[model samples]
Target: MENIVIIGNGIAGVSAARHIRKLSDKRIIIISAETDYFFSRTALMYVYMGHMKFEHIQPYENWFWEKNRIDLVRGYVTQVNHTEKKLLVDNSRTVAYDKLIIATGSKPNKFGWPGQDLHGVQGLYSKQDLDLLEVHAPNKEVCKRAVIVGGGLIGIELAEMLRSRDIPVTFLVREKSFWDGVLPQGESQMINEHILEHHIDLKLETNLVEIIADENGRAKAVTTDKGETIACNLVGLTAGVSPNIDFLKDSGIALGRGVKVNRFLETNIEDIYAIGDCAEQHEAIGSRRPIEAVWYTGRMMGETVAQTICGNKLEYKPGHWFNSAKFLDIEYQTYGWVFTARSKKESEAHFHWRHPQEKVCVTIAYHNETRQFLGINTFGIRMRHEIFDRWLTESRSVDHVMEFLKDANFDPEFYENYEKDIISKFNSDMGTTLAVKNKSWKRIFKTA
Candidate 1:
């Protein structure tokens, strides 16, 4: 049996290990820098907001490792010696491997604004960062202000969490809209309205020149480029993250946008593969650039890399990239390509479904030309989560969806046929069930 070594024990690393176990009874070892139990980092915001307990974030029980017969090493990886096929650990120990996988992910990027190293300035990237924020959490009654410096999903989520604690949150973004790089203008404005209504202040088209610190090194205020200063006791930076590839740089492994891998996710070096946030994936759409690092994308790449190493020739082709985020009691989702250029001339159909009782709105986006569905964004509704998933996986045209929408009700046979068509196209499963006792689902439509 070959010895397979994987660095980083996050979601991507653990997902790869699970798949590789099914393929081979090999000696698989996972090297994790964090010594704690495997927990969902994405859900930490919920924990911070008191929506869920910290224990609820654990992804697996302690016996999971024993059941899987996997070895876990708690240490930071310092370097990868490609020639020797060994990984250098922080404590100077080296472990050899027949195959190596780098799923180390990325780190928070603080773009060198002055006084960034101040005591109260924080970034929410890992569990450690969450702990740091918890430690520096301001006294609600004494200091009620917090300035969050980013408008991305993570930044916005942090803003909501801060608001839940009754601390007034000010979101300062250099971009003119929320998630401007990913979301369209209309979608951004819709979510922005909901956020503002929830008592959060948004300062768009703004730049943070420097973080002003108090005598004790705590962040006291932020100076803006537009000749303004906002007084806040705490500052949270969510600028962005970059691929963590410092150790692999001189290892002769290819690096373009990230660790360059083919469709099989194999690195330039033999028996070496990269996945998760660190890997530069092949874009199934127009450009082959590294796509945004979403959890599902990382999971897909992890499984694909494992299969390839197990001698399976399966290729990974992502149909569409999607990310879902919720803020101030409203849920928002986005998928596929948000039109960037007018010359692209892509047609999109949108529909807003509102529930007056719940005061919620569900927006759907469809590609008009291909008649194929693209994405959906539902706010203040939970039942429509599956609707968004169907839209993303089915790859249906707008006309097909519009036709189904006209009927509104789907028959049993039609639902099965729709599910079959969707599974065939996306090569993934989206299970749907009917509420009636012993009754089957009549139809499942993909809405974009």
Candidate 2:
């Protein structure tokens, strides 16, 4: 049989392994330093919030890997020797392979701030982070306050987790509005207000200066660029993550900010491929960034690479960007390319609608001249992903999308109906009369 070695036990690496086994009985060995088995990274927050246990996040039982003839190794890959077709495990052990797949994933970014390496200061990414949180901030008595340094998705997740335990969180966002870079101004401001409502000390436009350490070498507080020091037991650096490619620095693989790969996810070296968060496309696909750290994209790249490795030669075509995330109590979903107001193209125009008292809102982007539907962002409203995906593929007009909006919603029985109110507002603003049509399954789930 042929030997196939994969680095990292993330979703991307494991998905590739499972699919490859279905195609061939090749020798597959997956190595990871993070955990013994793959667990859903997104559910890390839930685990911290006590909603689920760590083992519960795992998709398969413990015996699944052994039963499938997949070998698992627990070791940190310190170096990769591509020419020798071997990997340096834990600086001493060497593992050889016929074909290599690099899915090393991402690491939390650190900008070399003072006292960053101190105890009680860490980033929430891996299982180790969760374990450290248990040691450092198990309860409000042990951790009175947590100062999170970034306003991204991870930061919000940490805030919610800590707040669940009655531990106050002080969030620092460099942006004027929370997640304004991705969300439109309307939605961003709504989230800012929502954060405040949660009793979180949301400090907008604030930057972390340094983490103050106690006499015992643990984080005591953090000073900001504003020269103010707020006392806290934990400092969470949730600024963002970067490619965990530090091990490949001297490995001779082509690298930009991440491992450079072609459309097929093939790196510069033959018989070696890269995928998931660490794989940076040579040329960006559509409006997506060269490196997408989203979970679904990673799984897509994994399946795509497995096909090529199995002689099917498939290209990774992640059609129509879509993602969903939760902001405290609100649920947010975005499909296609709904750029922020500042980032909107010259031809783009947005139609925004907000419920009077509730946090529900939706923004529809369309071409100003053509009225062709561009994209949509929904908050506190559940919209069917497949419905928007089909509409984007069909190149439906904005008017058509509005008329059939009822069909696109995921829940029609209980959720508040806003199609009539939204259409009325759109007509008043755009001076065009358009009424919503009754939802039909044929239109929502149309095959064509």
Candidate 3:
């Protein structure tokens, strides 16, 4: 039997192992130094916020791996020798493999800032980071103030986690508006207001110059580009993450920003493939970034690579784009193409609607010339992914989408519907009064 070894027991590596096990009886082993068992990385914030325990984030029971004939190794792979088909574990042990998969995932980015390696300065990416957070910022007394230096998803998550324990958080965002690089002006402005509403010191257009350390070598304060210094005990460097492939620097594998892989997830070295956050496609795929750190894309790459490893080669094809995240009190969801102001190259028209008394709004993007629906961004509202996916696939027009918007709504029946109001606004803005067709009770109540 061929021996298969997968490094990094994240969603990608675990998914590949499980799929391969279903297809073949090959000996499979997953190696990781992060944790003994694979846990949901996204749910780490919930664990800190008292919403869930550490064990609750794990997808499978403790004995699931042993019962399923999948072996687990708790070690770190320091280097890979492609010619020998062996991996050096902790520079001591050698693990040979008939085939190998590299899914080491991502690590928090550090830009060589002064005092960046301080004890209380950390990034929220791995289990070890969470453990460090517990030590440094267990409560308000321990953590006087937390200064998060970014406005991305992870940055906000860290701010929320600290705030959950009544810890003061001073959020520093480089962008003029909150997440303006990704979200539209209206949506981004709404989030900016919402963040301030939560009593967070939301600092916009602020850049961290350096972190000042205390006598104990922990974070003491942060100096900004504007020469402003904020005193804080915890400094969260949640700027972004890069592919965790530092160990592979001398491993003879081709690497760009991440490990270079073909569409089939095969690397330059034969029989040794890469996937997930560590795998970068030789060419960009549509609008997808070269390094997509999203969890679902990692799982997709895992499943795709497994087929090829199982003698059923298949190209990785991550279909339509869709993602959701929470911003303070608002829940946001977006599907298809919804570029920010900076990236709005093509001529597009936007129809935006905001509720009078609620932090709810939806923005519809459409082609200015063709009037074809491009995408929709909804905040404080739940929309079915499948519905937008189908609409985007069918190339539905903006008018058609608005007219039948109620049909795609996934909110509870008792929840107030905003379709009529949205349609009225759209018609009023476009100088036309288009009536929406009445839907049967069955269609209206149908699940997405």
- Runs of candidate 2 with Cα error greater than 4 angstroms are none
Error of 1 at 204 (Å): 1.0
Ranking by lDDT: 2, 3, 1
Error (Å) of candidate 1 at residue 73 is 1.3
Query: TM-score, each model?
Result: 0.83, 0.98, 0.96
Error of 3 at 293 (Å): 0.8
Residue 367 miss distance in model 2 (angstroms): 0.7
Candidate 1: lDDT of 283?
Answer: 39
* Runs off by more than 4 Å, candidate 1: 141-144, 282-289, 340-374, 381-396, 406-441, 444-448
Clashes of each: 10, 0, 0
Residue pairs in collision within model 2 = none
In terms of lDDT, the poorest run of 10 residues in model 3 is 439-448
* Displacement of the residue 86 alpha carbon in candidate 1, Å: 1.3
Overlapping backbone residue pairs in candidate 2 total: 0
Candidate 2 vs candidate 3, TM-score winner: 2
Cα distance off (Å), candidate 2, residue 359 = 0.6
RMSD of 3: 1.9
Cα lDDT of model 2 by residue, 1-448, tens digit: 8899999999999999999999998999999999999999999999989999999999999999999999999999998888899999999899999889999999999999999999999999999999999988899999999999999999999999999999999999999999999999999999999999999999999999988888999999999989899999999999999999988989889999999999999999999999999999997788879999999999999898998898999989999999999999999999988888789899999999999998999999999999999999999889888889888998999988887787787886534377778889999988988876666646544655
Provide the overall lDDT of each model, using Cα atoms, as 2-decimal numbers.
0.72, 0.92, 0.89
Candidate 3, residues 143-239: lDDT per residue as tens digits?
9999998899999889888989999999999999988989999999899988988999999999999999878888899999889999998999998
Instruction: Name the best candidate (by TM-score).
Output: 2
Which TM-score value belongs to model 1?
Answer: 0.83
